[model samples]
Target: MSTPAEFPVTWAPRRTRAVLLPVCALLVVMFAVIAVALPANWQFNDRVLMVLSGVLFAAAGLMLARPRISADAEGVTVVNFVRSRRLAWAEIVGVNFRQGDPWASLDLADGTSLAVVGIQSGVGKAQAIADARALRDLVHRHGH
Candidate 1:
């Protein structure tokens, strides 16, 4: 059994953030250094382009850490790479994080399931399972 999570709690992929953010920072720095070290024949525009490319790469890396789940008294908000959805407690019917699954998912009242990427098993298995259980408890306590 998982311990109950407090209200207004937020869960994000800790390992993902820990790993990606630093790697992204390193890549960005490398890009900048490469831009500065480019041959003199390279135009200023070309160097700028390299720096811009690095920024874009960092942005993409940042997206990998974007998935998050925030729960409060009113409802739960799920944020994925490019989409964010808010669901009331009643809308969340169940939480599932079976073995081999990449992440947890929510069974919605609308007869559809929503992937909860914030609780990814591949990155941190134990934490993800605990979170899934906590979310299940929340659904049971608040979902009708």
Candidate 2:
């Protein structure tokens, strides 16, 4: 007999720290340099604090650059930085891949377009195209 699976939905693959960490580091460094080079009295100024806070935020954002998807056996869950939404299989109207749009998109019955965020854009044009096609096929095969 086969064992039942554990989680119904899981986070899709994303770009690892090796890629995102450097970008974050660069920004942090730049901010730190500015913060340090400011007038001595400006260290306690609100503007300086604001800049430092922003730099800290950037680091946090970089550390959290993972794309996650969570759901039950019923549907898929997508949570990107700017948006968080869910789509049941029945709610998914269709899948489409085309030029200009980033990655694949799941067209919803309600008319909202949800971008698929798990794929890395830096993987090159060919990989992106293949990924888009693969996602489209998967959505078509299993999604409504």
User: Which stretches of candidate 1 lie above 4 Å from their native place?
Assistant: none
Q: Provide backbone clash counts, one per model.
A: 0, 0
Q: Best by TM-score, which number?
A: 1
lDDT of each: 0.90, 0.62
Q: What is the TM-score of each predicted model, taking all chains together?
A: 0.93, 0.62
Q: Which run of 10 residues does model 1 get worst, by summed lDDT? A: 1-10
lDDT of 1 by residue, 1-144 (tens): 674546798888978899999988988999999999999999999999999999899999999979999999988999998899999999999999999999999999999999999989877788889899988888888987
Model 2 residue 63 lDDT? Answer: 44
TM-score of 1: 0.93
Determine the C-alpha RMSD for candidate 2 after optimal superposition of all C-alphas: 5.2
